[model samples]
Target: MDDLMKQLHAVLAVDKIDHNTVVKSVERNPYRRLLQEVLLERKDIIRSRMNLVALYETEEPSSEIEEILAQFENPTFPLEEINTEKEVEWQPLERKYLDGVSKIKEETTMKQTQLEKDLAKSLAHSEEVLKKHRDFRPVDDRDFSNVKQSITKHFEQAKTNLRGDAATKILVLRREIEQQGRKRRNFDKNTTDTLQNWFHDHRTNPYPSDQEKAELAKQCNIKISQVNNWFGNQRIRSKQQAIRMEEEEQKRLAALAAEESEAMQTALAAASTVATSSNLAAASLMTLPLVNPTMHAMVLPGMPQNLLAGTAGFLPQTNYFPTAGQMALADNGNGQPFYTDFENFGLATQPDSEQFNNYLG
Candidate 1:
């Protein structure tokens, strides 16, 4: 029994050593593991391919697949024997295809390079344009705005001042025109003489009619309004002169009446004395010589006929009465005299008949 047990132990120990050696050799061998992995991957690929074929076979086949199968079954050309030399030979079509591909790649590379250069140039040009704009641009926009506002304000003020000045000038010119209008126009000497003559001719009705005024204005070379004014003034002045003359005549008559009354009283006393002392017949004859009836008949021969006729009842003595023309001439060429020196001239109780006739005519 001991020999048999020893032999069994040796055999089991040898078998264990051989198993460990085989495991170690397998772990160290690179080709052996690669072979095993390749075999396992190949088995999995075959299983996936069989599953796909089964799935495709279960469904209906497409026309494209049937056409492909027909192409394989009835090829136009027989299978050619591949010559190793012909497989490596350069064909014209293959060379052309290769050249075309190479040319297209070269063109694409050139275009890409040109595009990069153009992009760089565009970027540079854009930067330059931006710089120039910045250089020419206004530094402060607010300053420009303020300047524009100031200019507008100045123009507005200038326009306002100009308008105001124009208005003021217009007002000043209008005032000057009004002042010129207010000034009176001086008439000529001829106009004055014409007006005076007409006034004397129409003394009875001094107010002229419209037609008469027009005629006078035409003759005098003056306006009708001026003629009317002249007539009005002449009428007023002549009336004042008439009043003055009447007052002077009244004073002279009163003085003459007082003198006549004194002379009568003296004569009466003398006559009474003469009658008592001397003969009554001589006293009566002396009184008759004192009262001469022909004394009033005395007149100057050189007196104007018109003056003589007008003074027939008032002042019959031409020596005591001057002609009306002389009285009119005494007035310095204005219209009429305001007062007459009747007392100094011994003109008493005489109406200016010649002047009245001339004025009426």
Candidate 2:
């Protein structure tokens, strides 16, 4: 049964989709029909055993009742209704009947065990039949749900039995097929690229009109839902990326501005230090006495160099005499000195005798 389920699952995985066309009539797999009959016969056997169990409390064993009981007890029993497989896994019915207040429950328990064993054998046969003839079971009167409800009523823990296991596999396959049927189909790369081009062209208004979406769907070999889903995801992601880029740009600009500001501050600090030192030097010079080298060089020829150096600062600008180096009384290297009235070797207090005396010196 497990092996057969694997085979069926493989088939389902390959055929992910089923056509949606419906018909009033269609040929079903005869093997599945046979399995259905087997289930129905099992149901009837259950009804018969229940009646036989009730009848056992009053009457003795009858041939018909005994015949019905033999089918459940032995899988190899010859049957006139259908060809049964002789190769069946047979399990003996083991029970420890206690001194119970209700023997009917015990009787029912035995009946359930008998039914469970036979149902497993029937399922094993069905599995074999499925290996060759498994096809899509259309939704109809012969639905597995009816079989599930009928069989599960007989067992307290149906999930542990083979009937439950087969039914579970079938239902799961049906669900998978239905879900795959409703799933959104994928498009090729060209189709997605076309959609991307449209999205970019309409960046200011990416939301497509209904008619535009319909046109796109037709052009792209996709459905409207696929178009809508793609556009929605694309718009959100594009905005998110744009916002990230803007944030990164802002951060870059801020870092650059901070660097420029720091450099400017450093340059200003160095320039301010230089300016402060220059101002201090200028301030120290402001308190010193002044002197003129040109005035000292313009001393009278008779005056000593030391005397001129000492008194040149007190001499008025227009009243000065040549130094000894300019004198022609001895052999001077330069031409003869031209002593104007202001450059005479005399004091500015000259009047007559005293001035003449000063001039003579």
- Using all chains and alpha carbons, the TM-scores for the candidates as numbered come to 0.28, 0.29
Task: In candidate 2, list every pair of residues with a backbone clash.
Answer: 299-321, 299-322, 299-323, 300-321, 300-322, 301-322, 301-323
Worst 10 residues of 1 by lDDT: 292-301
Weakest lDDT window of 10 consecutive positions for candidate 2: 90-99
Superposed model 1: Cα runs more than 4 Å off: 1-186, 272-361
Question: Judged by lDDT against the true structure, how good is candidate 1?
Answer: 0.44
Task: State the displacement of the C-alpha of residue 41, model 1, in Å, after optimal TM-score superposition.
Answer: 98
Per-candidate clashes, comma-separated:
0, 7
Give the per-residue lDDT of model 2 (tens digit) for 198-267.
Answer: 9989999999999999999999988899899999999999999999999999999999967755654454
What does candidate 1's lDDT look like per residue over 1-361, in tens digits?
3453343234325323343443344344456444344334334333433443444444343344334323223422111232224432424433443344344435544654665565455445434433332232222444334333433333333333333433343334334433433336678888888888878787777788899999999998988888888887888888999999999999999999677556545555653443344222223222322222211122111323333332222322222233443342222124433222232223334436466334223
**What C-alpha lDDT, on a 0 to 100 scale, does residue 169 get in candidate 2?**
38
